[model samples]
Target chain A: MIAELFAGVSTRARVLLVLLAVVMLAAPLVLDRYLVSVLILVCLAAYTGQAWNILLGFAGLLSLGHALYLGLAAYISAGLYVHFGIGPWLGVFPAVAVCVAVAALLGWLAFRFRIEGVYFALLTIAFAEVARIGFDHIGFTGGAGGFFLPVRSEDQGQWWNLRSGPTFFYYLALLLAAGAFLLCAVLRRSRLGHRWLAVREDPEAAQALGIHINRARMSALLLSAGMTGIAGVFQAFYANNLFPSQIFDISRSIDLILAPIIGGVGTLFGPILGAFVLAPLGEVLISITGAIGLNAPGTKALVFGLFLMAIIAGVPTGLWPRLASLLRLRSVGR
Target chain B: MTLSLYLEVLLQGILTGLVYGLMALGLSVIFGVVRVVNFAHGEFAVLAMYAAFVLFTALHVDPILAAIPVAALFFVIGWLLQRFVVQPFIVRPQHDQFILLVGLAIVLVNALLMIFGPDSRHTNLSYSYDSWFIGPIIVDKVRAYAAAAAVVVSAALFAFFRFTLLGTAIRACADNLTGAAVVGLDVKKLYALTFGLGLACAGAAGAIMVALTDVTPMLAPSFTLLAFTIVIVGGLGSMAGALLGGLLIGVVEALASILVEPSMKSMVSFALLVGVLAFRPQGLVGKPA
Candidate 1:
């Protein structure tokens, strides 16, 4: 199946793919630290957005609370690290376990009772809020004051447990994102992928065809949560800080979902393209405005809001698909 | 704890719940007709609160009295928002509409943040902290007034819906837009009006909240969430259901605070929301989906 899939790739697509790989591989070495950091952010956003895509884009579950998984991973790992002298390297294990467990629990409750559509979205939001509020009040996790890891500037040269310079973080994010993209790509070709698409398109019809709707939703949710948990671990160490409000915020959830929604839903490359387009642009907008001493309170948010509004109003189907059709590219998506 | 303490908490919770009903009324009415969740509901409320604050500090009007202008102003704003922004994409997919609303919410919030900065502003009315003592149960004057005003408004709105021709037209649109249009009722106009009416509810609630809490752009999501909880629990398209749900949520919140830490209050409120969705997705009063 993998060979056939690759064999189906057009020559032009392969050339572009090769060129893309070369650029990505050499980017860290050639680019400035700031650009490298931005690239890392773009990759991280792509990874997180891909995770969300499995649910909302592929399996048709619009979870507005995906930050719950991120929060779970960050808070659990951060809490364990701070309280027990463990590193996030070791912390990812427990975080993944708990994150998957919570995802399963939420998925079961939502899917088992067939609470779906916008209600499912609402349920996810409620759960995410529950996690945020719970974490904010726990004094052992530093409550609302914030929990920080002791990463000194001189720790840049180290690489044993993800302690390194900005370049190292960039590579790690790139690898993680590439791995996630591959996993999702493989999953999209597997039998499970076909079932997921069926369920997403029409649940009743899928059920009539003997697809277990609950199981399908659960697996997508669990897969999505596991991926999100990994991203959380990466972020926990990368940012070296874990504030409950920062991690579990609704806006944080929005940031993750926005990439896929804006790029294109149900497509493999949409999230990556979206991350590349949005994350750097957003950070750049903020920095550019700040450098000018504009001191505007929500310049970044204003840009994002306008961008999102324009996208929704103009290209509700999202950019990737529209661009794909306009460029006459092989429809490279599920 | 003691009987009197429980009574006080219960009464306070009920009053606060009524205010929640008022806040969610606009959301409920909008959902009933438009079938889109107005994510900007909370921001609209916050803006109304700011307007009320301006009225109190700049014009010497009472906060309660400021509710009238706030409501009026929000009605127009809501109408324009629905017509220009929301109407364009109302025919799109539900997810797309959600995105639109969420984007609008971001725009509204950041716009406020840019204009007002991050500081929360509140009116310092002469009776801000004044309370009425009634035999071991002390009631906040602001709370009582807010509750009374909310009840009167809700009651009047309820009667209007029940008897008025325009009100019935709106309900008909909610119940069956295509049929309403077939019957020659202006469905689009009714939609704008319903959305306006809903925003008016949010504005009135905002004015009442000026005496209860500070106005901040950051408070938007919580207000939206609170309204969601009330509207969902009450069931969409049911105003009385919203009031009952709001009261129930208020009592639960109060009890949770008394039983646990105040910080744990949201933990209880959201848990209750999850429980309700799990058990009754259509809500206590909503027709089954």
Candidate 2:
């Protein structure tokens, strides 16, 4: 499917893609442990960004509470692993299923009531806030004290337990990101994708044309939530700690969408490019701040905010589209 | 809870809620006139709170007395923001505008974080520890002062919109944008003015609120959400509704904290918001779209 999708790509672009793949595959081998960890974050962000792009970029549904799904998946999967002795690989299925169900319920409530635009966004935030508060009060998941996943020295090389070294996690994250990218490419060309575009561009017109607006939006939400849940599982094992206040924060949700928004929403490669640009840039800024003897805690966030504004004001289409156009590459999956 | 306790909590809620109403009134005004939801509404309020805090800590100025200068300063800030940051995007899609304001919100919040650090700060007014007893109920002196100041500011705002020519012009713009333009109203300038007025309300509310609670950069987003809940419950674009919604939310939160748990107060507020959204999206007093 990926080959078929890439068949029409220009020779230059194909070469670029292959080169990029080789570089990513070879990254952990040469880079330091810290840089490899950063790459893993970039890949994880790319995966989540692609997941979010499906709803916001493709279907025009602005959800400001996507962290709800991520946090839920993290808690559920980690809880299962911690208590039931189930591995993340097995626990992931239930996590994704729960997320999808939640998305279905949320989507039904929203579409049934004809909540659109900012109201819909606010509804998402409200749901996330409710979940955050609920989670904070629930002692089973450690509440505000935070949930932890026990780490054993003997599980160093266990891929099944997802307790391997940073290199293993990096590869795992890369696979997830690459898989998500290909999935998005294929989905963007599918009938549902076309419907999403149609609905996003003009919902009234799409409805007139016999499109199932609610169904399309619901499917997008389900898919996005499910995909994001997988990332959550990865995060559970990677971070080894989950706090309701931090995981379910609105700021976390904002972080998920920033890559897609900055990379060029609705584009297949935008999330990947955006993740690559943002994660490293953020690391660089953090290091710079540390080196300058600055004790400020929010300088990174401040820079990100300024960057978001600059992107919105100057390149509303985002960086990927402009860069692609500059290289004279044919618009892919448009 | 006992009846007197409930009444006391209700009175306290009403007092705090009045300030909340004033805060949301700014949001309602901007949304009504400029047709833009100030996503940074809470950040502006937090900035005002910081302003008042700085004044009080530095010059020993009372927060109540500091409200005026803070409001005036925020008015100019809001006006400039509308002109420079928001004006260009007025014709863009709603999503773009939302992102723009979200970005602005992020900037303002982190700026506060950088300036004030993460610790929560509050005014140490001399009368902060004092309380007033009226019959069977007790009122904190700070709460009474803040609530009284809120009432005064809200009344002045209402009078401005009612009696002043510029206020009428702004109202006319909100009523009919094209018509106001056709009638020789400088729509752009009016929008900036309305934004300024809205932020002024937020500033005053923030300044007054410093005496009631602590201020921190992290409080900004919650404040924004709280203001949003109030405005929505009261009905978007409705001035009176903002105040009404604030009072309702404040009372509900107080009741929940007392009846249930303090942590569950937000849960109840969100539940209320969801109920209102599900049943009455137009809000209690707002006209149906």
Candidate 3:
């Protein structure tokens, strides 16, 4: 079946995928620790990008404050670690459950109340801001003071604990990225995915065609929240701290959305390509400004802003899809 | 606490609410005419505050006295933004417009930060700390002045929209864009004017805020959220609704600060936003569709 799947794909696509996979696999080996750390960030961005893609691209839900999930999961996992000594892996289970439960509840409330479009997006933001303020006041999470995960190890090889070094996280994020991509591919071909696209195009028309719009949107939110919970777990372990202000920030959500949007809103490869390009571009801008000895404090943010505006203004459809058309290759997304 | 203390806080809440009302009204008007949320709404406030700050230090003028010029400047800025960056995306999916505003917000906020370093600054005069004691209440003079200014501005705005031809045309566009266009209204120019008027309101609010609170480049995001919450509480595009919503939010926030941690006081507005959105999307003054 895997061979059969490949047989139908064009030679150019197959070759491109092979080349991309090889680069992803080999990147950590050749790069230094600092560069490998950046690669890890790219992978993390890709994983979250795919998770976000399922909601915005597939289901037409434009959640402006997606960092709610990431922050919630991080606090849950990190709080459990800081106070109870529970490992992050163990903490992820409850974190995922919390995210799914909250997502389902929100979806039910929204759909039942007939809240859609910009109203729905505003509700999501309200929820995130509420969570941010709530977390900041809670004593167990240390309030605004912050909760720090213990990094007791001096040596660099604690794989199970997830505190070996940047290298361990580098591979972990790569695996998560690969898993997320494959999962997105599988879901894209599934019945739910098809229903999602139908709903995205026209909710009323899809509803008339016997598709359940509520269930479709609900599942997408749940799945996206679940995947984001996993990334949050990784982030808690990787960063070794959880500050509600930093984690649950509106800007953090913006960063998550930028990947799929800048690369391609509705394409599979768009997010991956966007993640690959945007992270490095941010770093390059920072380095270049530093090398030039400019005292510009917001160089990265300024650049990111310009890049997002340029993408929206220049190619609202996304780069990969446009590039595919230009190259006469098979389109990469559903 | 005594009833007198309660009265004092209540008076303070009403005053603060009036300024918040100004912020909310700006957002309400912009949405009413332009049909898109300006994510950079709060940045306009920050801009006005900075403008006030500069005039006070450079020309030895009262920040309140300088507010008019700032509002005018912001009006022009808003007009240009509508003409270029925002106007193109207005016809696309509303989601695209939201995205456009998000990018615009990032650019505005970061650019401001680059221009004005991240430190918080404040203006102090001999009268800054002085307050009026009316019966049981103690009102800071600057805050009182800001609230009084808010009332005057809201009145002026009410008249502008209710009596002016452009205001009626704006209302027509908000009510039905196609119909307004059919009626020969210049919807495009009206949109620019409406956007300018909205930013001008924010500028007025920002200048008032400079007298009462410290100025910071980061002030806009929170104010934007505050304005959004007030707008949600009041109802979309309803000027009267913005006034009532802003006052209500202000009172609730003040009461929350007294009852809970001041740091947690912001949650009151957000919680109200969610509650209002879930149960009453039409808002306090909004008629049910």
Q: Say what the RMSD of model 1 is.
A: 1.9
lDDT (10s digit) by residue, model 1, range A224-291:
99889989988887888888887898888888988887898888888888898898788888889889
Task: Compose the digit string of candidate 2's lDDT tens values, residues B36-131.
Answer: 988899999999999999999999999988999999999999999999999999998788888888998999999988777889996788998999
Clashing pairs in 3: none
Task: Name the regions of candidate 2 deviating beyond 4 angstroms.
Answer: A332-334
Q: Find the candidate with the highest lDDT and give its number.
A: 2
> Model 3: per-residue lDDT, tens digit, A154-213?
634767667777777888899999888888877777788899999999999999999988
Q: Looking at model 3 chain A, which ten-residue stretch has the lowest summed lDDT?
A: A1-10
- Candidate 1 recovers a fraction of native contacts equal to 0.65
Superposed Cα deviation of residue B220, candidate 3 (Å): 1.6
Best DockQ goes to which candidate?
Answer: 2
lDDT of all predictions, in order shown? 0.85, 0.92, 0.85
The residue-level lDDT of candidate 2 at A296 comes to 36
Output the worst ten-in-a-row residue range by lDDT, candidate 2 chain A. Answer: A325-334
**DockQ of structure 1:** 0.71
TM-score of chain B of each: 0.96, 0.98, 0.96
Docking class of 3: medium
Interface RMSD of each: 1.3, 1.1, 1.5
